[model samples]
Target: MSEEKPQRKIIHVDMDAFYASVEQLDNPELRGKPVAVGGSETRGVVSAASYEARKFGVRSALSGVLAKKYCPDLIFVRPRFDRYKEVSNKIRQIFHEFTDLVEPLSLDEAYLDVTQNKKGNPSASLIAKEIRERILAETGLTASAGISVNKFVAKIASDVNKPNGQKTIGPDEVESFLEQLPIKKFYGVGKVTTERMYQLGIFTGADLKAQSLEFLEKHFGKSGTYYYYAVRGIHNSEVKPERTTKSVAAEHTFNENLSSEIYMQEQLQAIAEQLAKRLKRYELAGKTVTLKIKYSDFTLQTRSKTLPYFISDKGLILETATELLYQERMKDSVRLLGISLSNLNNEERKTVVVQLRFEF
Candidate 1:
């Protein structure tokens, strides 16, 4: 007789409006008021909007001027990425207390594999609860968790009861749960894909499942296979720990755009310093340095150079970033300055030298 495969326990934790919530937690004046963390309302974009602002149709990636139009009383706060990174590190530390298989999707969300965990508890739901509670107790912030057998279901389940709540989908309930799910709710089904599905008479998971694999593949290609299996609760992706830093970067959008070379250099220096600190903290060095610039009119450009050797020094970063900054003439007044280190020297395995003794 064939043996049954082991079912893995996974959890997806997402902070509720993380950036905006952090702002509200730190500043009492911002609580209960429509708030956005981004640049000025004059000529920039919204990075995150609080729930209060969301009610007025303000959302991240929306232009600040339009966000203000949506919410007349919207208060905009500049983003403090350093503080956000600090909080993210705290959250990751908490995850490690339960399990080492923590995969961070961004600063605000992560997937955890707790099938074999330090706590020796079999209940993933209980672990998630404890993690959320600890995050609130330690950082004074709330997070929502979804416990399931796989990452796909867990991620979708996390959104079912958002804003400081959780949901669990057991192995037995997978099919029933997917059947009634709206097509729009399916992962990877964006607005355009959802509309296409609607045009094809596929409104729900049930509708999608009705099509044969050949039909789906014929119409949707590779993504169709994804939807075919995903709706059946057959996602098998694993959570991978961030064993190495991928890129070190820092960027700042100015309150007022500056045109002078001196002002640009000042901003680049600060960005380079921030990048240097991040690289040093991770014990990483890179051969490629990239400089990202955004003009007052919102046009963007990037210049990069690959050094002969990997360097993590602040002086090298500042010098390279400064050189990139002046490599081209100013197209317009600059509103944003950014520096990033790529081609990192990560994932290298250390070799151990051993001495052999021979007895005659």
Candidate 2:
């Protein structure tokens, strides 16, 4: 008889409207208001929009102009990335308490491999609920969690109930769920892929599964095999830790789009302070500082410069970031502004020396 291996347990957690939520949480006046962490205007793109703004079709990465069309009364505000990172760290600390198998996907999302956890918890669903609750309790923010037997199902499950909700995809119900899953809901099926799939009559998991493996492979290459198995709830991906993180950033959206250079520089200053805090917290230093800007029309632009050596000093990073911001030509009404540090250098691992003794 063959020995049975333990099942893989993965959990996916994502912040609900991360940037916008942070903005709303910090200022009581901002709550329930149509707030966006991007420039307010038709020139810049929206970086992050609150739930209230989203009702008007406002969304992240949309041009400020389009956002206004969706919600004309939308109030734009500059991004405060520094504050967001502080909140993110608090959330990360909470994840570690349950299990060390954390893999941060971004500042806003992560995958946790809790198959064998520190707490020795039997059920992943319980752990997920607890984590979501803790996130709310600790950061005054809402998060959604997806618990499943593997990474693929876990990620999909997390999105099933969004904005302060939790969902579980048990092993038994995997097939039934996939059968009704719209192609658009599949992880990798983006706008371009969906349009193409629609034209080819691929609407749901059943539609996707009807195609032969050979045909899918012919079109999507190696990813085709993923689609073939993914629709059937087979996922083998692992939770990769963020030990390789090389940078940290902070950014903000504005209430009103600004074409004025002076105002944009002021926004950069705030973002720089926030970026510096994250760098110091992680004990990291970087040689490069980058400034990101978005126009009200949704056009994006960035400028970056590398220093002679990596440093974690706030003043130095801000100086370099400020320089980069100035170097760029202000062409349109800026809706969003951001700052980030990269090309990191910090402490190296210590190697211990051991002595051996010979006895007679």
Candidate 3:
């Protein structure tokens, strides 16, 4: 007889238009309007757009100028990342009540492994429901959830019922569910990959499954092997808790391009200060400092240096960033300047080790 496979319960939770929803909740007047959270319409890009704004073809990452052209009445509000982080902490607290196996993807999304939970609850769906209700009650915001046996399925399922909803995929239904899914709907399959898949006559999960593993590997490289097993509902990747923060960064886009090195240094100082505060808040320090510059002609350049010791002091970060800035020859007038710190020191890093066992 075959050994029984271990079953895992995973849940993916995503806040609905998190930033725009927060804006609406705080100010009653902004509710039900086409609102975008970003910089001024004169420059910069839309960071997030409300569902109403999306109706007019406005979306996150769309340039602010184009967003205005799409919806002239679109209200652009500056992003409040600190406020969003505060709310994210509250949501995380709720997840902890059910499971300690929580992995935050961003300020608005997370993955929780509840196969074994604090409440000793085996029903992942019920836990997802309770979580959503608690989030709505505590934050006055709606979150959608997806519950499944693994991270990949759960992450995809969460989006099926977006904007204050939830979906579940049972173990028995996994293969069938994937077979009917469109190629573009697969997680990690970007526009370029989709175009390639379409050209190869692979438009759905079923079509992808029809190809031999050897054929997939020959054509798509390592990812082809992933698709072969994924289509058949085989995924062994564990749900990692507390995803690492590889870097911390802060950036600013100016209305007018800056040509003078002195003025650029001033902007870099402010950005370094912001980065230092973020590092301090997270109790993290780094040995590397990187400077990024975007010129008016849309050209981008970056320079980085690694220090001997990890330092999170504002003055030290500014000094290092300025040095890097000056080292690079000016390509063109700058429109944006930023700084980032890497090589973080995370004290709570988790590692798992496996050993072979033989049954007598």
Identify the candidate with maximal lDDT. Answer: 3
lDDT values for all models: 0.87, 0.81, 0.88
TM-score of each: 0.75, 0.71, 0.84
Per-residue lDDT of model 1, residues 1-360, tens digit only: 112323678899999999999999999999999999995678779999999999999999898899998899999999987789899999999999998888888899999988878897878899999999999999999999998877888998999999899999888787789899999998789999999899999999999989988888888999888888888888877677754567889998888899998888988777888888888766799999999989998998999999999999989999998899889799899898899999999874333222122110
Winner on lDDT between 2 and 3 is: 3
Error of model 2, residue 182, in angstroms: 0.5
Model 2 worst lDDT window (10 residues)? 351-360
Clashing pairs in 1: none
Question: lDDT tens digits, residues 1-360, model 3?
Answer: 122323778899999999999999999999999999995678779999999999999998899899999999999998887899899999999999987888999999999988877886668899899999999999999999998877888989999999899999988878899999999999988899999999999999999999999989998999998888888777767767857899999999897899999999999888988898899777899999999899998888889999999999999999999899889579889999999999877655784523122110
- Model 3 scores worst on lDDT over the 10 consecutive residues at 351-360
Of the pair 1 and 2, which is ahead by TM-score? 1
Candidate 1 lDDT score relative to the true structure: 0.87
Q: Which ten residues in a row have the lowest lDDT in candidate 1?
A: 351-360
RMSD of each: 8.4, 8.9, 4.7
Tens digit per residue, CA lDDT, model 2, 1-360: 112212577889999999989988888999999888976685767889999998988889888878888898898989877787788889999999987778887778889877766787778888898899989988889999988766887888899999899888777777788889999998988898888879878999999989887888887789788888888777766666544676788888888898887887777777777787787766788888888888899898888888888777767877777777678578988899988888888433332222122110
- Model 1 stretches with alpha carbons more than 4 Å out: 1-6, 243-285, 288-307, 311-341, 348-360
Ranking by lDDT: 3, 1, 2
